[model samples]
Target: MEPTLPMPAAPSSIHFHANCTPTNYSTSPPNSWPPFPLAPAREISSYLNHSRHLSKSKPLPSLASSSQPRTLCFVAMEKKFVEEAGCCYYGGDVDVDGEGRATALRPAALSRPHTQAFHLAWLSLFACFFAAFAAPPILPALRPALVLSPSDSSAAAVASLAATLVGRLAMGPACDILGPRRASGAASLACALALALAAVFASSPRGFLALRFAAGLSLANFVANQHWMSRIFAPSAVGLANAVAAGWANVGSAAAQVVMPVAYDAVALRLGVPVTVAWRVTYLLPCALLVTTGLAVLAFPYDDLEGNRSAAAAAGGGNRSNTLWAVVRGGVGDYRAWVLGLTYGYCYGVELIMENVAAEFFGRRFRLPMEAAGAAAACFGAMNAAARPAGGVASDEVARRFGMRGRLWALWAVQTAGAALCVLVGRMGAAESPSLAATMAAMVACAAFVQAASGLTFGIVPFVSKRSLGVVSGMTASGGALGAIVTNRLFFSGSRYTVEEAISCTGITSLICTLPVALIYFPRQGGMFCGPSATVDDDDNDDGDVGANDDYMLLK
Candidate 1:
């Protein structure tokens, strides 16, 4: 096929200040102002509908890019208002039209097109990665600090686990009701604050558990952030852009290998090992880092062209129950939502099971020290995190080369192969030295390859139904939760099976059952991820016109 075409260049080439001021600032002496390039096409087209609301009587705020700091330019398309043309590198003013948008302000100092959106999406994914690592590694450090026996610790931690499960379940509805952009920003902030507080006050399992629960709530960011990007970028760019984000997220997971160890050491030094200090510090530091990133999200800049579904549609929310039923009953009463959700869940389930249980498997089967085993365990989580983002980008390239449908099949084929390798690992566990080495190698390779599937699973979600991105996300996450818990719970086979054996078995099963589901759900001839050239409004109008102009209407 033709070389994968790059997404269109953003609206502006010149870097300029984009101060987002309400139409009528308190008539106060304006913060320092400067001159710059006019609005980029993105700045104009993204928000046509929102601009109408900006002013029914006045020409929408003149669009101009500013190089100097504190430069302000407002654009309103159909009354959806973005006072700033560019994105903010750091956090600043933000009043989202809905919960679906993960939009942020761009620092007037920076002018790379779609830079703000890309940066925020990456950070959001990073924050999600942060939580992913924190829970598993910090469990040990936290236990002594909380002064709980294993049983008590489990009880307290259960809430956090529940929070993630429930949060995933709830996230989609919130996004559908509120919108992806808004939901993501809110979830990110909520997570940051919860983690921060837990860090400072966590003396017992209960306190930290609460914090974990809060942090888990932010997992919504994974779904919402991707949706936010889909809103901002055209369909063609989404695959590559999301791949980068997902890959970097996994990188964050990989980095956590280093971070978690250092964090454990740092806290132990100050608070002493086997005490609560290390755990508190470990949890607390992420709070600061992630919150700071969340703030940056709040301060991210606008693309001027992208639009949100919720606020645009009267800021009215959806009936989550109905929406969810729709997904289960077949999306819009068809196969769209469940198929994608199942595929994503199946893939997510396989990867997370391995990452979540690796330490237990290795420590028990191989009899390694906790930390040593965990170090190896971190490899899988690290791989999964990095792979998701990179895979997203790779999927996009595949889509560009072969069509979006090809990306789906490609990811499925890879994940299936990885799962097959996992089976090989388990079977070889009781075999010769060659068997063990081969299995281990397979585990590592699958660890990395599976993420591409994960990335594609999520990257494709938003476009399935621009309006239902959140619900779609929630359903997929819900499926993920089921897959994660069910697959792992089977390991509870009281002395029935070894951990590695269980994992290997689940891996094979997921590939066997879910991979085909993905393929069948996304048939060969259909589109997987797509967005119209015009905004949702344009689509609505076109439909309306067709209805009005239908020749059959002559009788009416």
Candidate 2:
């Protein structure tokens, strides 16, 4: 007789076959059957009891079948969980995984390639300013060597600045069409070639002036530098990044003031070279540096205006014939861009004018030696290393605290203070016994505020229109140059107005410019003219509504 075995427990979700046949199972009840040979019925009953106890404890699924709906529901739930945990559904490309979130919130240190791009952009801008201001620092040497009278030298200096202004105006459209990498590289190369030619073959003052003017085109690299930084850094950090680039580059002018004279003296004394030849040779180093920087820009992979490796790659048609024209039109149509340009003109333009005239002002006012005055004047440009970056950092903090209003508020505060400082400096200069220390202090304060204002103005530039950033940057920079030119004409005009009067005039102009800045409005947070009605598409969407926000957002 067969032993009576206990039943084993099983999950309801699983089904098992109960057929008993020679090919399938033994001819006995499933719970009672034992495929393996048992010594006696007692052993089979004991085995069945142990199996039933184990099944009751675990209730494991049978090796038979599973529900299709349950399996598919589980799969769908797992997929949904993954997407919720790992995906960004708001059009951002950032992954939402643990590591991805960490990376997005606090990015890793700049990689080598990014670092290289930053350094190259900085060096290129520095070289441009270095070459542009090279002639000014050595103007004393050039005066006699090139047989330039005081008026002639001053006019030539202003001409170089004027040329830079024109270059900046054109650079906007060029940067948009050709892209910053190519535009920067080409401008740098042209500057180097011009400097080299001037150093080697410029015989007369006029010839040298012409070459220097040509070399001043390098100043257009300012636009390229800012554009590069805008692309490389996050929107929140772009203010500081642009300020650092601008500030470091502006240091080139001060460096030239200090280094060029020393280099000339070193070459003349150590090499026993003639003064004329030594002065000319002094340009070779900066020229070589400029050329090398240009080549580096060409070699490196960088983004164009549209954030592409190349302009052709960015555009499907591969034809940028109308790009320049469209950029200009778009830039001009945006009143906010022009207002910012005007604001920049007051701050940066004042800096440019003061940079060129500070030495003369100090020399004439304090009756100091040329060398001492030059050193004192250098203090203005040198302050850039600290002041410019500080401005940018401060602007970022203000934005964080106050949102869009904080940016404009910061701009207004600094410009107003700057205007006051300028007036104070003028008042001190006009006093009977002018205090050189006091005036220098005032000038330094004024420079800091002015440069800070420049940083603040640009902090809002990228928000104006992503597609027209290059054009906007170029136009605002050109405004600085134009301001300088107008100020220079007033200050340097045939001994008509004194330095104090000119300084006062600049202060008055800057104070007035702050009004427009205060009046400017934004439609959305972190956006100037970029609202739903004014959305700009990358594919040349030129509907009448493209810049419609500009009209309503300018003063609301």
Name the top lDDT candidate.
Answer: 2
lDDT of 1: 0.55
Tens digits of lDDT, candidate 1, 26-53: 1222334332333533343343224434
Residue 85 error, candidate 1, Å: 8.7
How close is every model to the real structure, measured as TM-score? 0.69, 0.74
Residues 1-556 of candidate 2 have per-residue lDDT tens digits of: 2322223442222123323121211122334433321122122223333343343344333224332211100000011111121121111222121111101211233332334556788888898888887777677677777788877777777788788888888887777677788889988998898878878887777867776786678898999888777655555667777888888889988887777777877887888898778888998878977998999998875452122333222322344533555556767778888888888888998888788878778888999766677788888888888888888888777877766677788888898899888878888999999999999999999999999888888777866755567788888888888877787787656778777888888888889887788556654543333333354333433332223322211211
lDDT of 2: 0.67
Compared to the true structure, candidate 1 yields what TM-score? 0.69
